[model samples]
Target: MSKISKLFKGSSSSSSSSSRSKHRSRGGPTPQEAIHRLRETEEMLTKKQDYLEKKIEQEIMVAKKHGTKNKRAALQALKRKKRLEAQLTQIDGTLSTIEFQREALENSHTNTEVLNNLSFATKAMKKVHENMDLDKIDDMMQDITEQQDVAQEISEAISRPFGETFDEDELLAELAELEQEDLEESMKSMGGLPSVPSSKLPSAWHGHRTTTKKRVEEEDDMHMLASWAT
Candidate 1:
């Protein structure tokens, strides 16, 4: 009887330990409760997934509206625009410098042409003046040569004798008397000379006076010779 009581106590302790182990193995909940907890966890995870997807979609939409799909792409485009702007500014500066240099070159060319034309004109004028001076000098030399020839001819005529036996002084006086008579006749035929002498006359004529007496005497001598011969 003692041995059977000990065996029953041992079996009761073993059964209690087994029941506690079985309860602990089920995680202190029923199968239906576990299923409900799993469903709740699944629902929360689904809602979080949906919220994240919607937020991602909204971000994509915002990016599309702003014209870029990503931050890096947008930054690259901005940098490209800045570079293009800098290039355009540099090109404009180069063009401005070229235009200014072209204008200056044109002005310099124009000034050079003007200076060349002015120098040519000045040279031409100087040549013309020199030619005119040479022409005037030639005219003066010709006039002097003509006057010398006339003077030589007059001197030769004055030294020649009128007849074979006449002295030079008597021949010259007779030629002078005849020239005076002929000049008076010519003046009378041309309606006579002015009472006042010409300003251009030689100074030797200023004191001279003449008459037609020698002409009348020579004419009477010629008539007497003609009568005697008849």
Candidate 2:
């Protein structure tokens, strides 16, 4: 019993000493130190908050100035930007997946591996056709130029015959002479009208016959008178 009491007394003393030591080690800070630490923390937090606020204000001002023309447009642009950012993230993920696939393929040693690949042959053909079309356009332009030159030459040739004036009187005289010649040729081909001739012979023949008959009758009367006188 006495040993147990001694042990309890020792434990109590040690605990009391440890408590007093802990109490003595704890000291009060100066007002200035406390205030300075608080002030420093506050200032740092304030500066951080201020910088964030300024950045937000600047972003707002920039958005107001040039982000969009109107509130609705600005909202739409923000939404669209968010959608684009999401699409970009998705594209990045897809590109990362493609890179990983490519790395895996490169690491593999199989010669008969199948892969999805894009062929640029069509695009190259399209470019070639575009260049060809451009060349054709140039050729068409040259052809047009040549045609214009030919047209100009033809125009010059046509204009070379007549200097500035035309002879109106000479043309009119030539037309009149042609018309007169045509008229004279037509009249000569159509001949003139014919005429008849006259004759006189029947009346004289009948009168001579009557005279002979009368002479014959007178001769007969003279013969009868000579016979009576004889």
Candidate 3:
């Protein structure tokens, strides 16, 4: 570009910069500084109000002291007390206004900070999700759901019965019945009692029976001796 144009641009830029600085300076104090100033003013006003109250009380006492003995002095003292009370009232109003302003400033500062944080969070979220979109998310979820369904089907297939099934309870019941039959048969066989012979027998029969018993005993002895020898 031409030298004249460049010089003009430079001057314009400097003027603009100065204007911005001036505007910034004229924009007044920050929220915190303003709030601090307001609070200080409130405290000063409060102290002044207290002083005025005390002065008013003193003036009342002076007026009471003059009572009717000195009506003009009493009137003057009462007037001074009224003026002090007015001053105190004005201070009270001023302090209220300053407190309200401080509170408003604090709230505004808090809102601004909250907005800044939200904006930062929004930017970060956008940066993190820059390459992501709803379509991809939906597709991913669909794939996950499909995989889960396949897994569920696989699990079900694995758990399905592959062989013939029978009622084990019925088999156990039949086995129990067989065991009961065997038990009953064993008990029946064991329940038999040998018949007992009558102690009194005819002489002839007894002599015969004794002979037979002797013969059987002799055979048993021979068999036992044979077994021992072998």
The clash count of every prediction, one per candidate, is 0, 0, 0
Sort every candidate by lDDT, greatest first.
3, 1, 2
Cα RMSD, model 3: 16.5
Question: What's the best-to-worst order under TM-score?
Answer: 3, 1, 2
What lDDT does model 1 reach?
0.60
TM-score to native of every candidate shown: 0.30, 0.20, 0.53
User: Residue pairs in steric clash, candidate 3?
Assistant: none
Candidate 2 residue runs with Cα over 4 Å from true position: 1-62, 66-69, 110-230
**Candidate 3 — worst ten consecutive residues by lDDT sum?**
187-196
Which one wins by TM-score: 1 or 3? 3
Candidates' lDDT values, in order? 0.60, 0.56, 0.78
Q: Per-residue alpha-carbon lDDT of model 1 for 1-230, expressed as tens digits?
A: 65435554665576567557767997565434434434443444344445445545554555455565577755555555555456555545655665565566556667878999999999999988875677789999999999999999999999987966857998899988876676556546656443554465444544333334456546655654454446
Candidate scoring better on TM-score of 1 and 2: 1
- Which prediction has more favorable lDDT, 1 or 3? 3
